[model samples]
Target: MNKNCAIVTGSKESAPYTLIVQTTWIYPGWFAGLMKQHAKVTTLLKFIETANPAHVLLEINSEKAPGDFDFVGIPNSNDRIAEGYAKTAKSLAKLITKKIK
Candidate 1:
């Protein structure tokens, strides 16, 4: 029961906080690694920590980075996944905020 996939945002306005989306059961660390690999995504983690996540998401599933946030092949995606995602996303937000300072 490993739910590694997570879609997170710094905002709490609505369900789709930012442009970030985790459609699969992947880890946030791996997502950060991919973000590091992308040359086009400047201020990548910063943007994720701030606002407007849609811009970086444009390059998410592309060759520059390979990932799908469509949430497929995941059984009972709404169970333990939500809690795990929350924890992971919260940790990432804290790390990003710390790095920005």
Candidate 2:
């Protein structure tokens, strides 16, 4: 299994205001690429619709929020690597960050 490290930080929840750190794994790629796929997006949206949280914090490698995790370190077949997959993951991460706030 390919493993991409994701660090979740900042969670301060009150009765009225809730803060959460949601650490989700994106196998073989970052979060955005995972969501861009039609099937994957559908699945993710379904999960979001079901588990509606107050706030969320996501950690992914991006220019805005550079992550310490390395996608190449994951144990995945070379053939599965897509072009600009990392950016996609970053984009997804951004979306999650927005939803949290």
Q: Give the local distance difference test score of model 1.
A: 0.35
Best candidate (score: TM-score): 1
* lDDT of all predictions: 0.35, 0.33
Query: For residues 1-101, what per-residue lDDT tens digits would candidate 1 score against the true structure?
Result: 02322333344665433444444333322224223211111112212422555444332331122222333322333433443444444445554566666
TM-score, predicted candidate 1 vs. hidden true structure: 0.32
lDDT for position 44 in model 2: 20
> What are the root-mean-square deviations of the candidates from the true structure over C-alphas?
12.7, 11.8
TM for every model, in the order presented, reads 0.32, 0.23
- What pairs collide in candidate 1? 23-69, 23-70, 23-71
**Which ten residues in a row are the worst by lDDT in model 2?**
37-46
